[model samples]
Target: MRGAIAAMVLTFLAGSAAAQDLQARLNDYPTEARADYVFGCMAVNGQGRDVLRKCSCSIDVIASLLPYEKYVEAETVLSMQQVGGERMSIFRTAAPAKALVADLRRAQAEAEILCF
Candidate 1:
């Protein structure tokens, strides 16, 4: 009986640690990046209090779905795609770049469904 109680305590501690780790990962996006996302989302959706809430929720969902590094890679690819140069063509045409963008897009889509 004592062993069972100890095992339960250990299990609960392990679960708490796991939850904290997941929360830290989900919050890996920098404040600036999260703000930028929310602002862009609000601009596209609308500038209102409710829009603010939804936009915040959207970024949170995206952060939960994607890591900060992956998000940055996808954003960089998208920005590079806009430059008018032969070098920029790689971002526009490369499979790897497309895949990064697709991952970000999928996260955003999931965020949309959840938040809006």
Candidate 2:
């Protein structure tokens, strides 16, 4: 029926729109942040052209998995955890901080499995 055909077309268009939105969000990830991740990944894996490809793939996967704002929050918590001071205790011990870092870690782990 024409109604059934129209409903299928509407569903397809909606799904296509959502996919484009997700791709736009992933593209919004910053270049500097992506470069920093690739650099650190190369340092751990090895410095080579192949490592470059793998690192780039890793960041792409991470961007797909995590929104840029949440990624930045997780990175900030991790960086603050490295400092030594009473003020820094919250970064190390707070539940919210731990959860943010955990989410980032999970994303990174998934990226590694998929890309590396």
lDDT of 2 by residue, 1-116 (tens): 99999999999999999999988999878899999999999999999999999999999998988899999999999999999999999999999999999999999999989888
Highest-scoring model, lDDT: 1
Model 1 per-residue lDDT tens digits across residues 19-114: 999999999999999999999988899999999999999999999999999999999999998899897899999999999999999999999899
Q: What is candidate 1's TM-score against the reference?
A: 0.93
- For all candidates in order, the CA lDDT equals 0.95, 0.94
Best by TM-score: 1
lDDT of 2 at 28: 77
Query: Model 2 segments beyond 4 Å from truth?
Result: 1-5
Model 2: ten consecutive residues of lowest lDDT: 22-31
Q: Against the true structure, what is each candidate's TM-score?
A: 0.93, 0.87
Clashing residue pairs for model 2: none
What's model 1's lDDT at 107? 96
